[model samples]
Target: MKRTLALATIVALSLSLGSCRKKNNEPIAPKPNPEKPAPTPGTNPTPGTNPTPTPTPIPAPPTPVNGDNNNTIKPDESPVNATVSIKLTKGARVTIKSDKPLTITGAKLTETQHTYEVTNESGFGIDGDPETLDLSIAQATEFALDKEMPSLKSLKITTEESLKKLSLQGAKNLEQLDIAGAIADEQTLDLSKHSKLRLLALGNRPDMIGKFTTNLGKEYPSINSSNPSTSTSFKEVSLPTSLEVLFLAKAYCALVGADNLPNLRAAYIYTPKAELLGDLSFAGSTNLDRLMLAYTSGGGALNSLTIKNKPHLRDLFLYQMTIKHTSIDGLPTNTLMYKTTNYHLPSIEVHNTPAVKILSLLQIATNLESADLTNNPDLTEEKLVKIAEKLTAVKGVNLKIEADKATDAVKDAFQKIGWTVNK
Candidate 1:
């Protein structure tokens, strides 16, 4: 009985030892790592490096002017739709009140950027008695102020299409006004009321041709007419008395009222397609400084040019044109430069112009041509020779000069260059 019990104990011990060996040889699972993150999908993982995260982008803020919360606009915000947009500058502001909600675009936010409402979808008007209103618009025809705008100082309107009509009444203090784009054939602005206007720039298009009328109903002669003589039928457009600087581009009109503008200092007209009809006279403009009439690409005839009583006239440029009659009486005393290229003047008098330093008379006409410089006491022999050298050496040119001014050298200089010098 004792031997059997000992054998059973030995068998149990062997079975326990076998079970312990089997448990030690089995495979074990590892704990998850905390330092390294898992690799992103479709990415090649390094030996033991963590992947970088992508950052999110922040949005931009709204545009602000001088930290004013009201005059702020986000970049992604939609633009306001407006028929007429006014861009105020130089501390000029106006508050426009309307019956309905109206959108006005192209107003740059400034310190004085006041909020404004359009009167209606079709028009605009001022709310209170604001002085100055500066604005520029495109793709519009007519934009007239509803009320006087009593102290209004300046105004500017630009359009993509031709401006058919414009009206701003009771703007007596308006100093400057600039209008661009094509003006209609019958468009007329009676600026005689704006007596305080100093600068006026009417930038008309090249192809537009219009007439000048004292009365709006009656039509005068066309500026591009074959006969450019002052007729009893021709009417004059009334200008302001305080107009100092005037710029007219592609303006084909019989502009006849320089006697009214006593303070006219400078006038520039560019009429590329029309002839300057009638006596192109500036009879009463005493303060005239510079006058430039450029018919750049046309053969327009200036019938008579009268710059009478102009003491301060310095520069005069008549490019690509024809002058019918010009005498020494028409020349300004203080005229420094007189240039007329591609010209067709039969005779010109530059006898007593002491301040005449630069005289460019290239491409003179071939019909009965003559230039008399005999009475020029200020022009010496040296000055005459220098003037002769500057002239374009066209053959068969006749030049009459003073006997004292025409020396052997001066005669040789003029004669060698195909000019007949008659002393």
Candidate 2:
């Protein structure tokens, strides 16, 4: 009866304590281990009442993985060499979560006018294996050649994405753009909106390169195409009214119009076996000053045809061939030129022409200062003196005439050129 009474009293006390704790709400404390002396390693400690040591709670810095919560752009210049990481707007899903090891040689926030050109001017070859060119790999070539960096004036692209990248940068200062390889491809970038563009070279992609010169006579100006795959030629080229220079060098099998290039100031032609002298004459090229017709055959030249209105034709060259009469009829004064050796004296009929101020006959003209003219056996001192006096208008004097026999004054001049004068 006494043991039963003890158990009932303990149960009543436990119930009263629980009810008081629930109502008052005392805070719970973490359990702590009981202190004890160090025991030997081999001995097993008693089980039931054993305890774990308490660990120190430390604070940590905010991080992406941990939801500490901070969203702001950060510049990472050290992430890559000479490169900087900028904040990318969340338009597309950018996976820059650290796994893409980008060892950037360069990084910057840039728009269109700023360009990076990779040129091998020092004649260095790229080194590396082509099979390993998995763009994901650090940009390394299979073979490395010397780096020659020549400043590039312009660039061309057939890729729509690349074009878009360049377009996003800006086109205010772009001088020349070429997409000739993509003109026929619809996937090529559309560049017709670049109104300030002075030069455009396009291919036949038709979509990416777009139909720019279809009404070339009316719409897009200054467009050039030489794509053999898509058959792009001069058939669709429209010479802009503001054009100052037009180069048609290797378009022999491709160029279409012969005279439609109006207002061309400078032109380079290499048409072969073609008779274009009649139709090749400039119609609206009244302002034409420089015209190069190298390697273009079929007889008619500056002198053969009537260039009656080209008063400004200052520079003319008929090298590597015999130009028929009338090739130099209407040439401007002081015309710059070069031709085969004149074994016989040339007839410079335009002599005393007002515009004829400086005439160049020697290849190395700027170096020569005076000529030893007194040596020619056929021409005497009187004749040389006259020629010298006339040539006084020219920058340098040339009196180096060849002959076995020479006058005393001529021998003196020859001595000046290191020749031994006859005793």
How high is the CA lDDT of each candidate model?
A: 0.49, 0.30
In candidate 2, how many Å is residue 30 off? Answer: 83
Model 2 C-alpha lDDT per residue in residues 47-98, reported as the tens digit of each score = 2222212211111111112110111222232322122122212221111111
lDDT of 1 by residue, 1-423 (tens): 999999876655434522432332211111222243433333222222224122111111111122224232222222223223232222233343222233334323334434333323333332333333334344345555535555455555445343455666656666666565534456556678787676666653222111211221122122233321111111224578878777665455556466668878777665653353566767778878677665645546777665556777655556455677655444544353332346567776554555243143322333337766667666777866776676667667678877777789889887776888887
List runs of model 1 lying over 4 Å from the truth.
1-127, 204-237, 274-277, 327-335, 338-346, 355-368, 372-375, 379-386, 398-416, 419-423
* Candidate 2 local lDDT, residue 187: 27
Name the candidate that leads on lDDT.
1
Task: Return the TM-score for each candidate structure.
Answer: 0.55, 0.29
Against the true structure, candidate 2 reaches a TM-score of: 0.29
* For model 1, the run of ten residues with the poorest summed lDDT: 55-64
Candidate 2 residue 96 C-alpha distance from true site, Å: 23
